[model samples]
Target: MKKILLFALILNSTFFYAQELRLLRGAITENLIVNDTVNETYSLYLPTSFSVDRAWPLAFVMDLEGKGKAAVAMLMNAAEQEGYVLASSNNISDSLSISQNVLIANRMFNSVFNTVPTAKNRTYTIGFGGGAMFASILPTFINEIKGVISIGASIGNLEILNAKQPFQFVGIVNRSDFNFRSMYDTKQVLNKLKFPNQLLVFDADRNLPEIETVSKAFRMLTLTSMAKGYLVQNDSLIRSSYNDFFVDANANVTNQKPLLATYQMSDMEKIFYPLMKLDSLKESQKTLKRSTSFRQANRSQNSYFLKESFTKEDYSYYLEEDIISYNYANLGWWNYQMQELNKLDRSAILFEKQMSSRLRGYINALISDNIDYLAADREPDLEALNLLYMIKTITDPNEYTSYLKVISTSSKMEDYGTALFYLEELLKNGYTDTQTLYSIEHTALFRIMPEFNEVVEKYLKGARYDVIEQ
Candidate 1:
């Protein structure tokens, strides 16, 4: 396999790279100045099992912003458990083109590869959300990135995907993630292309994958390594992981989490098929599916998935239309939709709750995507950003940052009335970061106004500015 051989090559890279590399083993340390000219940096984690004698597999974690430390922290436990070297860049940016980001990631890769004895053939790209999207495509540009572990995103940069550069892809997503359907769809495409891949559907938000779920993804990589002869097959490790996963899936079924159990069965089937015959696994899968509880749960989840897809389409169409028209009047409609989501979230049925959560997440992601794209322009439409931020406040009510952005944008435009209104709305909705309110850009004069102080005093009991009654 092209993917297998690529990883096998990394094992042969010389000791020239290892002796010079100084690392704090067993803990992640921020490599503050890996590339000084561009000020590129990364967070590196060396498992306690790491040794200088052998080159180790590398997980190059990609963060959308310069959050290398946090990203590495997310996977550090799994890396420790799996004995993979972890490096996450602190320079990937949303403003950069896919090519530009890949170039930046490559620079970080060079820094790590040269400083650390990483198995060149076993290198993988890892990311969450936008970072995941970026990670999935890096293999196309760089031949050495042999696999992609994407949490919360499906395959990306499709136009550039080269069949010759095919790599192992392990996609991890939650059932309620907006990307759930897309991840499944990508599975079909990967199957068609004969790309070695697995999709693990766990139960959590896109950003909150449990450590067990993440470790399972890494385990798949290691097992692939064994299959490729890069590492000696450890049947004990295989049995232990398979048993852990099987127990979790059975626990899910026992807990009435049929959707999660079924998804786990699929993951189990793909992950172990390369290592051994899957007759027993297949039989277990059939037995689980044959259960009336599993059947009913599967039907409900599928129905909700369809409904969730359509609702997302509606949200996208309306959001685009509203953004194009600057339709402030439609704010009420958006608010109403959020209210409807709340109803679903409160529904007695499990499927409706899942669908509602996904829809809420989808709309927020949609608006945030639009906001980022618009704000990246040299002459960004401030009005649209403000509108999207307002809608964000409705969809994700507790994200105080959205409320602050709306206030800042409105105040910058001298729409004091609008700014003051959101100030009150934000406070009414339980925002109490008084210091942050005072520091919002373009709100210096706005924050000192009588109405602003009045609203602040009314909600938080102490206004920074003396509100002189007019």
Candidate 2:
């Protein structure tokens, strides 16, 4: 056993020696292969100020499709500014079983732990969209993870949340993001469980939050640790951070954003109470909540929430039933509902517009969930996945992913006519990734046809291709 352990130690040392030679400081190193058997790889970014003498904070990022470098890039600036080591796995994927993916993640975690001096109390995992859901699940099973920064998604298994192992959660999502409601509810649940958590709301689509927002989240996690006595508290740092949040909340009040101001103050009070006294924070929350504008906005949002929830539940139920049964006849009804939502989006009333947006977000999320479920099966239902993609386009036309799916799947089935139609629709939707179009599965034969060449030429000037006549 000692001989075997000696050999293992030598292997690990040799592996990391090679890594140390390539792991440059202050920039992202893309596709650092970890396990050769499955081609398991990860991207890593280390702060320029890194040293082997002291433990460093680390963040594990998940990118669903295994775009490790892309995900690393999104958080690299924040990680550098905050002096945290960032790593993302290129092999972890949404299509893989959760257990399988988690095992891969565990390997990556063990590898990183062995390679670097990681601060155990500061280890965090961050992910976006489906990847965010994966990140949220880590703390429940992986006790080493202390926090999660979930962007554009929420916790998957609420039943797994345990007070015994409470983890810090910082959710950054846009107001119009499909997962906003779920994230909001998650914050409430976390609060009930007395967990350290904050949900930052921005105003945009499903995308990475600003670098500043990411930095703030990192700082908040640090504060949580300090407040919990896991780290030595710096009074100056505590005061400075508290003042920044308080000022931001006051600024929101001045900017005619009473609701936002109120929530900000509320979060501050909850997060900072254990660290220091906050008379001003408490007062600010009361003032904003009592303000007429805040009251009115709150009432309007309540009404929108109720209506949106009803629509979401109804659609979720019907969508699941339809997907399970492959009910194509209901496509027309879904289309009609989409048209109605379009009208509501254009409505004069603000509440109507908000409700419509939430409803649209809800449906898109449901379809995505259904597609993911069907795709995860050992023998996936391609027909059902295709149908969900089609529905995704109708509900969220601006999303180019669904169009690409429809085109690829139709071409694979030799349904040239359907492929051609979606190809044009994809172009009309402003999808300019021509290289991606040509590289899709089973598209070689379809792209070489006369009709495709004609369309490509019309849309992309100076584009020409020889059509093969078989």
Q: List the residue pairs that clash in candidate 1.
A: 6-121, 7-121, 7-122, 10-120, 10-121
- The digit string of per-residue lDDT tens for model 1 on 312-393 reads 8889999999999999999999999999988987888867877787788788888888988998899999999999999999
TM-score of each: 0.89, 0.81
Writing each residue's lDDT as its tens digit, candidate 2 over 1-470 gives 11111111222222135334356678787777675566688888888777667788899998789899999998899998878999999988877899998998998887677666788688999988888889999999899999999988988688988999988889988766657778888889888889888887765433568887888788888888888777789899889888888887787778776776776777787678999988867776777788898999889878888878888888988888778887868878788999999899788766677567778878887788788778879988877888889888888899999988988888988989988988888888777777787788889889888998777766764334765557
Top lDDT model = 1
In candidate 1, position 423 carries an lDDT of 88
Highest-scoring model, TM-score = 1
Worst 10 residues of 2 by lDDT: 1-10
lDDT of each: 0.83, 0.81
Candidate RMSDs in Å, in order, are: 5.0, 5.4
lDDT of 2 at 379: 89
Q: Which parts of model 2 have CA positions greater than 4 angstroms off? A: 1-22, 31-39, 205-207, 317-332, 346-354, 372-389, 399-470
